[model samples]
Target: MTVRIGIDGRVLTDRYHGIGRVTHELVRAMAGTPGVELVVFTGEQSASRRFDLNLMAMLPGVEVVPVALNAVDVRQLWRWRPLLRGAMVDVMVFPYHLGAAPLLGRPAVALVHDCILETDPRFAPSPQVGFAYRIMTALVARTATIATVSRASAREVERFYGRRVHPDHVIGNGVDRLRDDPAAARRLESEYGLEPGYVLHVGAQRPHKNVAVLVEAIAEVPDARLVLVGSADERFPDEVAPAIERYGVADRVTRLPFVPEELLGTLYARAALLAYPSLVEGFGLPVLEAMVSRTPVIASDVPVLREVGGSAALYVAPRCARAWAAAITRLLADDDLRDGLVAAGAAHASHFTWGAAAARLVSACHSLAGTYLAEAAR
Candidate 1:
């Protein structure tokens, strides 16, 4: 039997961040899957940063439904049920946390990427936001079939919400193979003044990201240059600039707020190592991205990162600047160690692909639809 699945595509109307990328890739792959038809409900396109929803709509067995509501629009909390029923979908998938209200008697799947807002106060920024997250989490936990990106994240969800995510429902994230471009590498060298073998960090400068510790580590490596590629969060304390100044390494560090994917791939290919000092994460996607680019990685000795990087990355204590510095220096000085890590990392990253993730999601949808239909017939 065909499983007609409905998904919240509002994430596609904005810049493609982690969740947006997951939703976009999964739907794109599911469109080609046999016996599956997708009804993607999207909001009006963003004027400044819109992802092309038409591309997915044009694919076989896929349809796009435009709504007046955005992803974060509070109205969706109550309004989504009727629209979902009207679409006559066998199952509904909420790619993010916000829009998954109880679907009356309908079966729904809620993708819980992480419970950072509930676990980390720094991420919540305010008490009201934290409280709202608790309510939303509780509601979704009771109503929807829970899914997450990693086993580590599933444990976290169980810890906080008392909801268990079965092993089969733990749909992990994936990375694409990035090709190296010599011309783009040269452009980065000339235009951005980024030298080859520089230590690279790619993530938003959030409080939990531990950017200050990375800056401190760079300071200890007198000859090492650093490239930080992500936007700075104003809500949290500004640590990157202050640390760069305090360590007197401003001249050695290049900060780019954003870069096109082509340049980002080149940066990843040209860097000596990718340094990820995040204290916590849902999946640690950058670890896989770097590995696919054949770049060595030095990440925090955190569970989620360990799950993603496996033995392919060199792990360091998240808060230890000296440990990070030593790891960076050792990796740079040892060619054999770097080459071994690159080979292992590439092999490890190959196991994770969007096609595999999409297959898992399609299976989950089929299971939900089959169960619901059997119950209805009874």
Candidate 2:
């Protein structure tokens, strides 16, 4: 029997951020899988954005369906329910968990990236957003089988929301191998005012990201400026500006709002080190991306980071600026240690490929649709 999988393709928009990248890559891989027919449901907004309709059009088992409802269009889902029923979708996979309400009785797979709002409420931009996250969490717990990007995040979801009957699976994220692009690096250097030898940090300056520690640690390292390549949080800059001014490293630190993927890989390739002092992460994607880019990583010694980085990355205490600085300085001076880490990181990174992740996703869909247990006798 063929299982028809309906994927919520709202995340396939032009602004392909972390979640969007996960959805796009996983769907592409799953579309190539032998047994299942893949149907992607997209909205009008996505049609106008940088959606991957071209690739879907080329794939053999994939069908792209335009829906009148957006991902968060809970009110519209009921009105559009007939379309889903008519298509005979065996299971629905919501890559972002925003469309959980409409498919309540169906075997729905909810891809929850993180429980930041549930576990770390301070990270939510506003109270209204926090409330909505809580509601979404409840909806997942009540109606769907959950799939998270990391084991750490799965545990968090189990602890906070799905404490009883909701099933959870860990389908980790994957990174593409970086190509050496000297021209891209030179362009970034010229356009973004980035010098060659600087410590690189890639994340939004949220509270839990702990970027200020890097700001302070950079002051202690000699001739190494910190380049932050993410959207700046206004609150974090207030804290970072003070530290940079006090350390007199104002001119050394460079902050770029958004770095395109090709240039990002180049930036990572050119950096002296990738410093990720995040207090928490669902999955430390940048760590793997940096590792694949052949850059040595120094990240916080948190559970999630430890799970993602393994022995490949040098772990530092999250809040200890002195310890972070010491690690950076020591690694920079020791070429042997850096070489070992770079080689080990590449090998560690190869363990996480989209093909492997897509297999896990297929298994999750099989489990949710009851196809595995039912067809075991065959």
Q: Which candidate is the best by TM-score?
A: 1
Who wins the lDDT comparison? 1
lDDT of 1 by residue, 245-301 (tens): 999998899899877667778889889999999999888888999999999999999
Worst-scoring 10-residue span by lDDT in model 2: 43-52
**Estimated TM-score per prediction?**
0.96, 0.90
Give lDDT for model 2. Answer: 0.80
Tell me the spans in candidate 2 whose CA falls farther than 4 Å from its real position: 14-16, 46-51, 76-80, 102-105, 164-168, 233-243, 371-378
Compared to the true structure, candidate 1 yields what TM-score?
A: 0.96
Give a tens-digit lDDT track for model 2, residues 1-378: 567888888677744357777888888888868789898887767352334577776787988887777667757447545666777777888888866654434578777887776766677777788898787678676667778888788788778885433333688988888766778977887888776768999877677788889888988998888998777666333566677788888888998877766677889888889999988888989999999988999999988999999999999999999999999999889999999999999999999998888888888787767753355437
Q: What RMSD value applies to candidate 1?
A: 1.6
lDDT of 1: 0.87
Shift of residue 151 alpha carbon in model 1, Å: 0.4
Please list the C-alpha lDDT of all candidates, in the order they appear.
Answer: 0.87, 0.80
